[model samples]
Target: MQEIVSLNNRISQVIDNIKKVMIGKENVIVLSLTALLAEGHVLIEDVPGVGKTMLVRSLAKSLDCDFTRIQFTPDLLPSDVTGVSIYNPKEMAFEFRQGPIFGNVVLADEINRTSPKTQSALLEGMEEKSITTDGKTTALKRPFFVMATQNPIEYEGTYPLPEAQLDRFLLKINMGYPTMEEELEMLARTSQNHPIDTLDSVMTIDELLRTQEEVKAVYIDETVQQYIVNLIRESRKHPSIYLGVSPRGSIALMKAAKAYAYIKGRDFVLPDDVKYLAPFVMAHRIILHSEATYEGLTQLQVIEALIEDTYIPIRKEL
Candidate 1:
């Protein structure tokens, strides 16, 4: 229990630093870092000017982790993302040249702008946390995370991510438009200087590893586990849904909820924690029916319907 509290404090310190640059949207910041500690990737889908790229940079800065940005575009190639093996004529040997993916925090800015092939290059890295080049495989550093961003408003030239690739991400989040007061404060603060430039590292790699270990130790009630499974099963049963949450989605929700509990400074899980994270964890994994699509309904709204329909487990005294 003491260990859990210590990790909670460590996570809080790191998040407080990131919020300095991100301004409002504390929930978004919490979800991003939770995914990180859960040892999973994140997909940020929002409109432009919402600070998607800035969020990635700020996270890397606050953790003192290695940061690399890959501006994916139509012209981007697979080798450009995963690097290539070059035969050095001077040494008469093939030397492995690494790519931007060799970092603790990789910012795949405008990921959907690239062709499918280029976008798929991230698949191996995100899933395996490693890359293969010329039949050679290399391991990425610990705490490796891919914080990818996409512009939801514009899809004219973008290649949509396939379900298989989408399933790899633990959670899908968005930095919604800030309130007027928050925006005004942002303008006042950044009038002469960007807040991120002055940000400092709040945690080390070892500290993060420790916190991740602590998250696994969080207690999940048996009823809560049943709630998670039934909620996922319900996604498949929804009348507007053609497809449902896969087994991978179920596991993602479980892991994310545990991390969410830790962030709330609790050693035991809660139904509310699982409920709060359900949409983001299952939204991208769900497939709606043609009729539902024609109605212009969103996956988020559908998940909300499921949440309302599902029975919330009553909390029992431990």
Candidate 2:
């Protein structure tokens, strides 16, 4: 019990620290941290100036981790992202130079603007946590997280992320426009200096890594596990979906649920956790049929329908 309380307090501290820079996006903040604890990547789709970069920067700062920002463009090369081997005349050897991808928190800004080939460079790093170049692989740093952002309003010259790339992201979220009051508060706060510049590290990278391991220990009931599987199975059978979520979706949800439970200071997961996270975790992974798209149906609507119709297991006592 004491350990749970301690964990909750530490998580709360990081959340609060991020909230200082991000005015009123606690839910987005929580979801991003959930991905971090789950050891999964995030895909943030939103309009410009919605604090996407700020959120990633604040997260890296709050955890005291190495932060790297890669402004992906059409000219971006695979070697530019994963690094390349350069010949060293003195040693008569080819030396591998690490790219911006080798950081604790890497923000792939405008990720969709790059070519598909350049975008795929992240596949190996996100999946294997290592970069293989010239038949040699280099392990990435611990707590390695990729928070990628794409502009949804503008689609010209942007390459849509392939399904393989989308599946690697555990959660797809957006930072919507803030309320008037929140915007006013933000204006007042930034009148003199930006809040992020003054932001302090509230959690260490070592502590974050330890918390991630602890999150995996959070117990999940067999009934809840079945519920997760059912949701994934239903997506495959849904008439609107062209390509349903893969098994990876189920695993991602279960892992996310455990991390969510841990963040809430609970040792066991509840059905409510799955219910709240379904859309964010599964929606982006599905592909709507051409007919369904023509009918004006959306992914979130389909996911919500599944949740509404799917049976919810009775809450099991911890």
Candidate 3:
């Protein structure tokens, strides 16, 4: 019980640190932190200039982790993202130069603007946590998290992310335009100087790694586990859907729920946790049929329908 309280306080400190720079996006911040604690990547789709890059920077600062930003473009190559080997005249041997991908928190800005080939370069590292080049595999640092952003309003030259790549992201979120009051606060805060310039690290990398271990230890009941599986299975059977979520999606949802439960100061997961996280975790993984698209159906609507139709498991006493 005391450990849970301590964990909550530590998480709160990091959250508050990020809030210094980011205004009126508490849910987005918590969801991003949930993905990090789950050891999963995030896909943020929204209009430009909504603090997508700032959020990543603030997170890296708050966690005291190495930060790298990759401004993805049409001409970006595989070698550019995962690094390349070069011949060293002094050593007379090929040496590998680490790319921006080799960081604790990597911001893949405008990811959809890049070519598909270059985009695929992230797959190996995102899934395996290591990049292989010239028959050599180098491990990435611990707590490696990728926060990728894409502009949804522009489609002129952007390449749509493949379903496989989308599935790799544990959550798909949008940082919508802020309220008038929030924007006013933002203007006042940035009038003097950017708050991010003075933002300090509230937590250490080692402490974050330890917290992740604790998240993994959060208890989940058998009934709740079955409920998660049932939800995934239902997505496959839904008539409005084309390609349903894969087993990997189920695992991602379960892991995300555990992390979210841990963040809420609970040692055990409840059905409500799964219910709240379903759309963000499962919606992107499924593909609606062409007919369904023509009928004006959206992914969120389909996910919500699934949630409404699915039975919520009764909470069991721990």
Candidate 4:
């Protein structure tokens, strides 16, 4: 109980620090942190200039860890992202030079604007949490969270991310436009300077590592586990979905739920936790049929429909 309270307070502090700049998007902030705490990556897809980069920057600034940003373009090369071995004449040997990816928080700005080969560079780093090059493996630092952003409006020259790449993201967040009040506040806040410049680190790398470990220890009842499976199965059988959530999605959902519960100051998983996160975790993983797309049926809609039809388990008194 004491540990839970300590963690909850620390998380709240980080959220508060991020909120200083990210005004009125607590849900997005929480979701991003949830992905981080779950030891997974986040993919932010939205129209450009909706504080997408700001959100990533603020989160990176709030941590006492190395932050790097790679502005992916058509000319970006895999070696540019994962680094390459360079021959050093002075030592008569080749020395490996680390790329921008060797950081705690990496922001892949305009990720889709790059070629598929360049985008695939992140595949190994994101999933394995390490980069293998020249038949050598280099492990990333602890709490290696990726906040990759792509422009949804400009698909003209963008290469669509393959399914394998999409599945690696534990959550796909859309930072919608702010309300009128929020817009005004944002203007006033940034009139002089950006809030991120004044932001300081509220948490350390050690605390973050400990919290991530604790997230995995959050309890999940057996019935809740079954509930997650049921949702996954329902997605497979849904008419609108041509391809359903895979076991990876199931595992991602479970891990996200556990981390979310920990953030909520609870040590046990609840049915509502799974329901709240299912769409974000499972939607991007499913493939909608062409007919369904023509009919304007979205992945979120299909997942919501499935949630409505799936059974919810009740907990009995111990």
Which of candidates 1 and 3 is the stronger one according to lDDT?
Answer: 3
Which portions of model 4 miss their true places by more than 4 Å? 315-318
TM-score of 2: 0.98
Candidate 2 lDDT, tens digit per residue, 1-318? 677679779899999999999999999999999999999999999988999999999999999999998999989999999998999999999999999999999999999999999999999999999999999889999989999999883577788999999999999998999999999999999999999998999888888888998888899988999899989999999989999999999999999998898888898999999999999999999999999989999899999998899997665677
**Model 2, which residues run further than 4 Å from truth?**
315-318
Candidate 3 lDDT tens digits, 135-192: 9999999989999999873468788899878989999999999999999999999999
Q: Extract clashing residue pairs from model 1.
A: none
**Clash count list over all predictions:** 0, 0, 0, 0
Score candidate 3 by TM-score against the native: 0.98
Error of 3 at 294 (Å): 0.2
Local accuracy of candidate 4 as per-residue lDDT tens digits, 101-141: 99999999999999888999999999999999999999987
Score residue 191 of candidate 2 by CA lDDT. Answer: 96
Cα-based TM-score, every candidate: 0.96, 0.98, 0.98, 0.98
Please give the distance, in angstroms, between residue 1's alpha carbon in candidate 1 and its true position after superposition.
Answer: 1.0
Q: Rate the local accuracy (lDDT) of all candidates.
A: 0.89, 0.93, 0.94, 0.93
Question: What stretches of model 1 exceed 4 Å from their correct place?
Answer: 313-318
Model 3 stretches astray by more than 4 angstroms: 315-318
The per-residue C-alpha lDDT of model 2 at residue 35 equals 96
The CA lDDT at 236 in model 1 is 88
